[model samples]
Target: MASLSVPINPLPPPVNRRPDVKPEISLTAKERDEEKRRQKVNRKIASQKATSMKLRSEATKAVIGDKSGPSNSKEPLPLLENLRAHIAALRWESALNVFDQLHEQLWYRPDSDIYIKLIVVLGKCKQPEKAHSLFQAMISEGCGVNRESYTALLSAYSRNGLFDKAFSLLEEMKNSLDCKPDVHTYSILIKSCVQVSAFDKVDSLLSVMASQGIKPNTVTYSTLIDAYGKTRKFAKMEATLGEMLREGQCEHDVWTMNSTLRAFGSSGQIETMEKYYDKFQCAGIQPTIETFNILLDSYGKAGSYEKLCAVMEYMQKYYFSWTLVTYNIVLEAFGRAGNLKQMELLFRSMRSDRIKPNCVTLCSLVRAYGKARKAEKILGVLHFIENANVMLDIVFFNCLVDAYGKVGCFVEMKGVLEMMERKGCKPDGITYRTMIKAYKKGGMNSHAKELKGSFASVQKSSPGLERQNLQHSVSRFDSNPAS
Candidate 1:
């Protein structure tokens, strides 16, 4: 179309020109390389930190063992075992340390159940302050609080005989609806008060519970009856039991009967024990294994071997499975009756029944053998235990020493002491007293003096343990047992 003067001017670069532009201040090659190195260093440091934290988290969780997790899970086995072992051994110090480690974990979250358990363990170990610290930690961690946890901490304080602190905590719980004191709480407090013979405090606590409209349950009444019976306050014991039978929230159970019988049995009131036993039986409360053991113990201690034999016959006729405790009671009864043959026979039967003998059973055997002038049998028992890989506790060693001493085997008795040292078992006060008595009887003044010196050293080394030893003297098994 013709001769149009088409002046298409040369195109200018696009307006943005991003591809052509360079930064105002560009990095030199050296600067760029330095920046790359810095980034690499930072990444390496961060990776190391991440690994460190991961290891710490694993270690912390390992201590706790995540007991709430499935029991069959294998990953937390060792930690779970550690927890159980420490708690079973009543190693409160180790347990608290483990608890602290658990809290320091990276993935750790507060848990009420864990705190409740720890608090209870601390109460058992009589470490009230540590328990209170755990409660404080639970609060600071923003965990849910409940009456059970409060009751646990209260128990700790009560066990330690910090009555004021316990009451203060109880009052504190009263003010907090979420952590209000229940029958268990008052029961624990009442038990503690009764333990220390603080009857006034007990009365006041009962009054407070009534005012608070918290009714006493079976446990509360059982604890009261047991405590009162222990103190020989038969009137109070009978009254509490009567109240429980009449108007208490819970019915009388085997435990109350046991407590009643124990009180009478411990005081050599076998007739009263039997009467109460019959009454309880008529109340539709079935006898437990513990019941039979208690009866056997009372009869044995009262020198009513005929009654003990009758009870054994009844148990056999009823096909009641003999527990480790039952075997121990029978062995002790036979031992006290000076029927060494029967005791040894029962010992064999105990093993055949697959019920492993504990220290109490072994002690009964030792005392029996000692009485029969068959001290050699004790050596046999030691050998048997070694062959069976049964753990040798200090009590067993003490029993060994006592048996040898009673037989006038001073050399063997001292050898037991040496064995104890080699086995890392510490000789307690009972051990020292036993050896000293034997030494004096043997007219070995120098040996007795030497033992006295060592005994003093042990006392110095473990001052707190002396009180615990005294408490354990009244062991769950009869204190004046066969051994």
Candidate 2:
């Protein structure tokens, strides 16, 4: 009886608490309008950034470098690395096929890490739905779900401009303590907002982060600086830079420096760019090839050809191997400066240097030759293109069409179109638009009108080529700021 008289250990009081969830805020009409204004300006800048970075990435691969090829030291599985390489190359189809092959291998086992990796790859390819499906596969495989997996899916949504879906997922994450959005998650979401030109939402996001006591890290500040700098909000950009410097743990890195330089450099503020470039260098951020490329572009555009040549010489003196982007930039600089002889010489030097020419290289050459009205030179380029075994792209063909059309060589121009078809390169809107202009210039009004009729579909394909039709043929390089 005494043993049964043990003190009753009462159970602790029931633990009960409501989860912390952020209120879903909506933007007012005024805020929306403000974003629209910023959107227009930011999109112009963002599009240029996107185009430049895309070609630059391609250029890096051309030069045996890779900006996005797994920088981590922990080597992944061999098949997984192949998948990553395909992803880095933007070979989405190949990546998917490789992944499929991996799944079928005898050694293959259900792995959440592999699922997340593939999901991230598809996200960058702008295939959010496909990534979403992969997420489902992860769940079905009994691999379980966590914040990282959800964040990867969120990234996919955000990357594809699926803001509503991303936010909804963010809400779901908020409801789940195991998968709440952390600083890295918010940084990605913020960058996504900036990409979509949702500048208005940025302040709200930062406010939420502050409320959450989540101090922004280097990546967060850099993203904001880049977004603001791209929108010409130098005060905001500099303010962000100041904040980053003020943070004891955070400092200016190559990314922040590069973004700031691009904002100033692309906007033709070479002086400001140089000022910041030197400042960043003093801060101990060594320049990369991208740095040299930006220098070349700024100097070239500012008519500081001497400085441009100096940068090239410095690269050579430092034994910096020139990338395809570097060659393209130099070639374009010479072309734009009307140094046709220099352009021609550089092209020959590139060939002799055994640097493989891509569509961009040929496009630059075609443009320079076209500007000089040397149709014969374009013919030589076409011959070189053939020997180089470069796949003919629509841009190359369109440039060819414009080159001949510029010289009133309608026969050759039409023949270029035929060559394009034979090479399985379909003519884009620019192709037809260039032809329409040439036809009008030749006083063939009916022919121009007929081609204009076909433009309905082409315009559907390229909604941004809204420029007015003119006698001057639209070369592919026309929109390339670097060119």
Q: Best-fitting candidate, measured by TM-score? A: 2
What is the per-residue lDDT of model 1 for residues 1-483, given as tens digits with 9 covering 90 to 100? 689676688555688445667658888999999999999999999999999999999988766566434444344445546766877788888877766665554445677887788889998987888888888988888887899988999899999889889888888998996878888888888988988899999999899888978889998999999889888999999898888889745888888888898888878999888888888989898888888888888888788988898999999999999888788888988897889889988989988998898777877888888777787787887777776766667677777888888899999999998898888877777888999999999899899999999888888989987667645644633453311
Error of 2 at 155 (Å): 1.7
Which portions of model 1 show Cα errors greater than 4 Å?
1-149, 175-180, 443-483
Positional deviation of residue 379's Cα in model 1 after best superposition, in angstroms: 3.3
> What's each prediction's TM-score?
0.70, 0.71
lDDT of 2 by residue, 263-283 (tens): 788788988899999889898
Q: List per-prediction Cα lDDT, in the order shown.
A: 0.82, 0.82
